[model samples]
Target: MSGLMQKEYERVKLHATVMNTLFRKEPSDSESPRLARGQRKTRESFDARSVLKHFKDYEFGSLTIPNIHLSQRFSTGQDLYYQCVAMAALPKS
Candidate 1:
């Protein structure tokens, strides 16, 4: 692999990490103290909007991921499985 491909692979991994973080993790109640009600509401609203935006631009099928080479690496099938896991963990408004 060349430097550019390695960079692209890293980028994709980072993108996957961020997407997983944004959509996968639940807002844990056992974490730090609560936010103000207004703040909580604001976060919920923002998350809802983000989710909607994602859905609007959604295309869950074959993809040409630049660097990651796993044969079945498109954001579909198993990839969909992970994305759904993330989206399911997203907050509702």
Candidate 2:
């Protein structure tokens, strides 16, 4: 699983770079292009700890992961499960 994830991460990084190089247009002399918020976030360091609690909510009656702070009640375990899934769906770099 780790190997698979590493491959996927590399694939996405390469694809992003290629797409940026091939399709991104240069700004006109009067304009400057800025990276989108999502692009900027992608470049920022990812703190897995910040999001880890969402994953632990998958366990029965668990309110928090070891290192993450608990903030609110989760209405149902499934809700937390989906949150974990969403986090997992994000590109890892």
Candidate 3:
């Protein structure tokens, strides 16, 4: 992944991890109004937005081996024993 992608991921992760604590903690009366206003003003709109906008479609590099072979070889629990074998057989792109 590019530096830009890493930066984006970290921004989103920080935003989410920070919000996780905020969401779980009980807000004092003084904190509630400011918090609600922050929600309204923030471009993300909500905590879910931070998480949803990032990581959903992050790169999963191409697996060049035939999809059909992968399916046939690893589709069942018994087949998983063969995945490492199949995986090692595959040439790195």
lDDT of each: 0.42, 0.36, 0.39
Off by over 4 Å in 1: 1-19, 28-74, 82-93
What digit string (tens of lDDT, one per residue) describes model 3 on residues 1-93? 432212322333212133433234444646765555325333332557766678678885865653222222222346432232222255456
Instruction: Give the lDDT of residue 32 in candidate 1.
Output: 55
lDDT tens string, model 1, 1-93?
432222334344433433333233355856857667445222222356767777896876885443343322324455544222121133333
In order, what is each prediction's RMSD in angstroms?
16.8, 17.0, 18.6
Top-TM-score structure, candidate number: 2
Off by over 4 Å in 3: 1-52, 69-77, 80-93
Enumerate residue pairs that collide in model 1: 23-86, 24-86
TM-scores for all predictions: 0.16, 0.18, 0.17
Per-candidate count of clashing residue pairs (backbone under 3 Å):
2, 0, 0
Give the better candidate number (1 or 3) by lDDT.
1
How much lDDT does candidate 2 score? Answer: 0.36
Candidate 2 Cα deviation (angstroms), residue 77: 39
Model 3 Cα shift for residue 53 (angstroms): 3.1
